[model samples]
Target: MTFQWDAIWGALPVLLEGAKLTLWISILGLLGGVVIGLVAGFARAYGGFFSNRLALVFIELIRGTPIMVQVMFIYFALPLMVPVRIDPFGAAVVTIMINSGAYIAEITRGAVLSINRGFREAGLALGLSGRDTLRYVIAPLAFRRMIPALGNQWIVSIKDTSLFIVIGVAELTRQGQEVIAGNFRAMEVWTAVAVIYLIITLALSYTLRRIEGRLKIL
Candidate 1:
C-alpha cells in the first residue's frame, strides 16, 4: 500500500534512458559475442590440433567461472595485469561479449557436430576444398540450427547488463536503485523496472521464436 504511483511516473523518463543504454550495450555485446562464437566454433570444428585446443580452452575457462567474477576481474583486476584500465561501460560490454561467446561457442560446436557426416563427405567428394566444404555444406545447416540457441544467449546477455551496475554503470537496474534511494519508494521503483525488463524480454522472445519457426529445417 506504500507504493507511490507519482514517484514511478516521475522516475520513468530517466529509467527509460537507462533502458535504452542497456539495450545498446546488450546489442553491441552480443554482436561481438556472435563473431567470437563463429570464429571459435570454426576453430574447434576444423582447425589444427593446437588451434582447436586453444579454442576449447577459451570456451571452457569462460564457461567455468561466474560472470560476476569475470566482470570484476576485467574492471578492477585488469589494470594490474595489463597497462590500461577499462572504463565501466567497456568492462560491461567485454564481460557480456566474452560470457555470451563461451556459451554460443559450445552451442555452435554442438550444432556443427550434430550434422550428419554424410553432408561433409559428400561436399569433399564433390571436389570442394575443405574451406568450401565448410562454407557450403557445414556452416549453412549449422547456423540455421543455431538460431534458437543464439536467441537464448542473446536474452542472457541482455539480462547480464544489470550486473554491470556493480561497477557503477547506470543501467536500468541501477537507475531504478537510484530512484528508490532518493525517494524511498523501493516497491514502486523496482516494480516499474521489473515490468520494463519483462516487456522487452518477452518481446525479444516472441521475435526470436518467430525467426526460429521460419528457419526450422522443414
Candidate 2:
C-alpha cells in the first residue's frame, strides 16, 4: 500500500490529546512511585527484620506478576470485593505507580546498600540520629547514584501507559486504534503513533541525561 505522508499530520491532533493523558498518567505515577520506592527502600535497608521481610514480599509480588493483571484486578476485581471503584484513568495511573515502585525500590535499595558504611558511622559520630544521617547524607547520595536506573524506569513507565488501552483508558495506543478504525489507514495511523512515541522517549532520554550530568557535577 502506498503511504500518505499527510495522513500522519492529520492524525497529530487526535494523537496529542491521547498523549496528554499518557503524560498525565506517567508523571503522577512516577511521582508516587518515587516516594514509595524511597520509603520501602529505606525499610529494606534499615527497618530491621520484619519490616525488611515485608518490603521484600511486597516488591517480589509486584515484580513477579504481569502489570495488566494487576490493573485488571484493581479496576474490575477489586470493585467486586470491596466498596471501591476506580475508573480506567485512576486504575491506569495506580497500576503504573505500583509497578514502577517495585523496580524503583530495588534500585533505591541497591544504591543505598552500595554506599560505604563509614559514611553512616561518620554521621552518627557527628551527633546525628540515624534518620538525620540518612536524610542529610546517605539518601541524597543514593538518589544521585540511582539516576540512570530511575531514568530507565521513567521511560518504561511512559511506554507502559499504552497497556492501559486494554482497560479503555484512551491513551496514545487507543487513540491510534480509534483513528485507524475510522479511516482504515492502519499503516499511516500506526506509523504516526510509533513516531510520536519515539519522539517522546527521545526527548525524555535527552532530559534525563542532562539531569544525570548535572548531578554528577554536584
TM-score of each candidate? 0.95, 0.97
User: Can you write out model 2's per-residue Cα lDDT over 150-203, one digit (the tens) per residue?
Assistant: 999989998999988889998999999998888888999998899889999999
List the global CA lDDT of all models. Answer: 0.91, 0.91
Q: Once superposed on the true structure, which residue ranges of model 2 sit more than 4 Å away at CA? A: none
- Indicate which candidate wins on TM-score: 2
RMSD (CA, angstroms), candidate 2: 1.2
lDDT of each residue in 1-218, candidate 1, tens digit only: 76679988999998999899899999989999998998898889878899899999999999999999999999999999899989999999999999998888888889999899999999999999989999999999999999999988888888889988899998999999988888888888999999999998999999999999998993
lDDT, model 1: 0.91
